[model samples]
Target chain A: MKFVGCIAILAALAGTALATEIPQADRRSGYSFMGPDSRAMQDDDTSNPGMLWVLDGETLWKRKAGTAGKACGDCHSDARVSMKGVAARYPTFDKALGKPVDLEGRINLCRSNHQQAPPLAYESRELLALTAYVAQQSRGMPIEVGNDPDLAPFVAKGHELFTRRQGQLNLACANCHDDNWDRKLAGAPITQGQPTGYPLYRLEWQSLGSLQRRLRACITGIRAQAYEYGSPELVELEAYLMSRARGMKLETPAVRP
Target chain B: MARPVLIALLATAAFAACGPAGAEGLLPYTVAGDAVPDSLTGTKGDATRGRALIVERSSTCILCHSGPFPEQAFQGDLAPNLSGSGSRWSEGQLRLRLVDASHFDPATIMPSYYRIDGLTRVGNAWRDKPILSAEQIEDIVAYLVTLRD
Candidate 1:
């Protein structure tokens, strides 16, 4: 009995030691990778193009839709008050689905369950607007998604995917984001794959995009078959990334070059 | 049973008519151990052209490799420096590495310039054709061999 207890203590210590993949002091937001022009754009909402989607989302929150004739505003009230720190804890475990769902998935769930509305398409204008609006409420709040004991298995799966090599190029997410961040790839900086900002504006895309879109682009970049949007794999990856970004400030609706 | 056999034979012939999958545009080459002993284009490559490709964005060589290219301001730090690759490897070894760097490290980020098969989700523009042509691969190999220091 004493030996078993000692083993348990050792295991807990190991878990604590392994908790941080990147040391807390070394963690840098993707915003730091941007130049002055892009940083200035994010700092001031008026110049930021992503604010357009956030504005549209504010309108849709009040406008009633679906068979239940409800607006997201009706139940939630003011997003600023109700949704504060909500986005920081997302890709939360869903009891009904017996898995986890991202912020977009959670919105779709609410739409289907409460409003009786058909789930919005992935990457749709409506979804992007609503997500941007909701996430924006949590801006500057530190992420806190790593503490759930139930999410341990899902987070483990996500870590496996992040470290595992895939596609024709056979490179893992860790190969660049973990091992070679802050280095230039043909003059382009490779930032740590932090999930602090999402539903964010990208100059390359010339529009707002979700994290899943970025993940798909990376997968395709490596010549690997990208997982379908909203797949369990993507949600798991998002959960893992959020866990990695725990304690980092949220920068939703961020502008990126 | 005879009809089933005939149908199977017909199906095989139909697939055979399309030529081997992913081998249509690729040039035939031999791999002996860790190297390709012959030039993929049957002739020597132009080192001058090869140097141009290494520094050019389209070739994507310098994207993951930093070398002795003095003119290029930004080069990558992902792979080993290209300065002494010639001293470290033989011509054939360099050729194989260019053809497929995964031959040495399976998890290498370097794309196979001359290989076409065993790849997935290749962009529409990159399908069927290898990332680099046989001549381009030979040129790169030629230039890589010159970096002796």
Candidate 2:
């Protein structure tokens, strides 16, 4: 009887130990991407060259696009209040289109629906600057999206994409940003993957890029199959990332080194 | 299947037992008090206290840096080796670094542990004070200076 009791006690101890050993689930489990440093550059022109885009955007807002006699300023008198905090809620689901939309997509929507001008192509300086200028309006607002039920499916899809492993590295976005953020891979600092600040001026790229463009670059870095511009996978990924940065304030036109 | 599951659970428990207390084993970096010097070369610091600070989960210093110390196993190799930092930098330069590494490398992800000025957008909770105290800085500097190799 004592032998049996001893065996049971040892088994109980083993079970208790195992239960405690489970790895803690990370909140950022699905996607892998570098996070911005706390002291990274901001939208101000003094910190980064990309801040020039905000100035250019101000000019573009005043200048008319297309043959139509309408400028962004014609409808919205002042971008400061009118467009402020607008960038923090992007990559949102649009009921009209029945899909997710990004800052560029929204810009095109405005141009086609309101201004009747041709939508700018991806990476166009005009679009980048305008987006930068517009995103800068919400410089200090915390990111908030997917609060509605309509966005749940898209957010879920994005989460799946973030955690799923891909590419030659056989690594998922979560593998680096979530699991190894604090641990460095090369010579760079590993930070929490937060997209609260974007349309950032990176010293390496020497220009501004949309969040979608940044995502594409990351895919390239890991040697994964690059998604086409504005693909659903990229859009979903953006939606998820914006949601992850829900409470973090936006710092559009952010500078990076 | 049950036996394998049981073995896996046992292994996991063993690993968890080795991790820092209250960290849930997720935080891999050593947390140090704000006493460590930011540079490798500097005045003598308290290695004994520095060791405690580095092992603390909140400081998060060991997240990206590696050193010759064996206790910190989760260090990432992204930054230069800090084992012999004392031989590389001076005390004043080390002071400047602990205050704000971003001033030196604009893209650095390291947080500013010292300077109370120039912060624009950090969360309200972290804004009022430097992460490390002046004495802690001195102690860390002194300790790092001991790392000759």
Candidate 3:
């Protein structure tokens, strides 16, 4: 299964090689930066702290909610069977809203639109758990967020945000993640800013967090005002990142330092 | 939608501008071309004190810069090494770089240690104040100038 995953990634890389600054041969997962202990934690579901949230998500999936009193399972049935490869193609264009909606956004939309429940609060434990649970079904599948023509403008905006310098420090996301990703910053190895393993556990955060949360932290680290959670800017950025990591294998509920 | 957010941001920035200045209010300094020839604090800074600040983790100097301090085992490699800053530039130039590195390169990741204006979304704890005070900038400049090799 892992070998098939690698070959699929390589094929995707080969197809998009000319378009990216990082060559296909040079592209690496953030997993390569982890030490042995972190790798062990990610490999073992029992020890991975993120699985706790995934477990909670499993419970939430079956529980009924809202005015309709309908559970997610009532419509989707078994998530493992229904949700397989679902996460790999997320932050997809929503025809109703005419914008991209991530995994969390889709879930909330399902609640309010179909189940008649209020949208889940961004960054809340309940939302995180549901997101983690959904994403986990696609674990080891290559991320396949397609080049939907509708997403191009938003992806460009996200690319602009990634490259444009901001904040008192006057640094861009590209400076650290693109130009100097291999170097160490105060004993911490800088990863290539891939969006593979999220809603993943972080030792620093001591909790599972979304990609938007991590993005806000980076913006703040450079002394910039972060966009609000669930903001369009953040969603666009997330779409761009998932597109950027198009070929990488998903490692949802992965552990990280 | 963006306009309201922009308005709110501008208002916040304006509010921060009206907040208390640095530790004892921002001391004015002269920028002569590419350098601030005058020390931020009128008095000369102590190199010993400056060295202590650079070596300390809280100051964030060594966080992105590896320096001549052998005692500190973990230094960053994100920026240029700080072993020969003295030999490369004048004391005045060092002062300006420490004060606002973006003056040299607009996109530099280095923080403006003594600049308070034109910043966005500064936390309450850091608002209205520069990252480093005049004395601290002077002290850091003093230490940087001593790094001949």
- Give the number of colliding residue pairs in candidate 3: 0
lDDT of 3 at A161: 83
Tell me the tens digit of each residue's lDDT in model 2 across B1-149.
68657645654664465423442312112213422223222234577887667545455555556777687656767556778777887655555566557556433445556544444333334434556665566666566666676
In the range B28-147, model 1's lDDT, one tens digit per residue, is 665678998778766789989999998897777888899998899989887789998889998899998998776665545677787778765555556677778889988988988999
In angstroms, the error of model 2 at A257 is 2.2
Tens-digit lDDT track for model 3 on B1-149? 78657655654564365523442356656578898886665567889999999988767888899988888888999889999999998999999899888777554668888777767566555677777777888888888899996
> Where does candidate 2 chain A have its weakest 10-residue lDDT segment?
A15-24
Write the residue-wise lDDT of candidate 2 on A168-236 in tens digits: 333456656655565654446555557765777776787887777877877765445667787888889
Cα error, candidate 3, residue A180 (Å) = 0.7
TM-scores of the models, in the given order?
A: 0.81, 0.56, 0.84
Error of 3 at A106 (Å): 1.1
> How well is each residue in A1-257 modelled by candidate 1, as lDDT tens digits?
99999778876753443233677799999999999999999999999999999999999999898999999999999999999999999989988888989999999999999999999998999999999999999999999998998887999999988876666565678878887789888778999999889989999999999999999998887767789999999999999999999999999999888
Tell me, by TM-score, which candidate is best.
3
Q: What's the lDDT for all of these models?
A: 0.85, 0.65, 0.84
Candidate 3 local lDDT, A1-257, one digit each (tens): 99999778875753343233566567677888999999999999999999999999999999998999999999999999999999998889998899999999999999998899999998899999999999999999999885799988888888878876666565678778876787988868888899998889999899999999999999987767889988999999999888888889999998888
Q: Which pairs, if any, clash in model 1?
A: none
What ranges in model 2 sit over 4 Å off?
A1-44, B1-149
Error of 2 at A100 (Å): 1.3
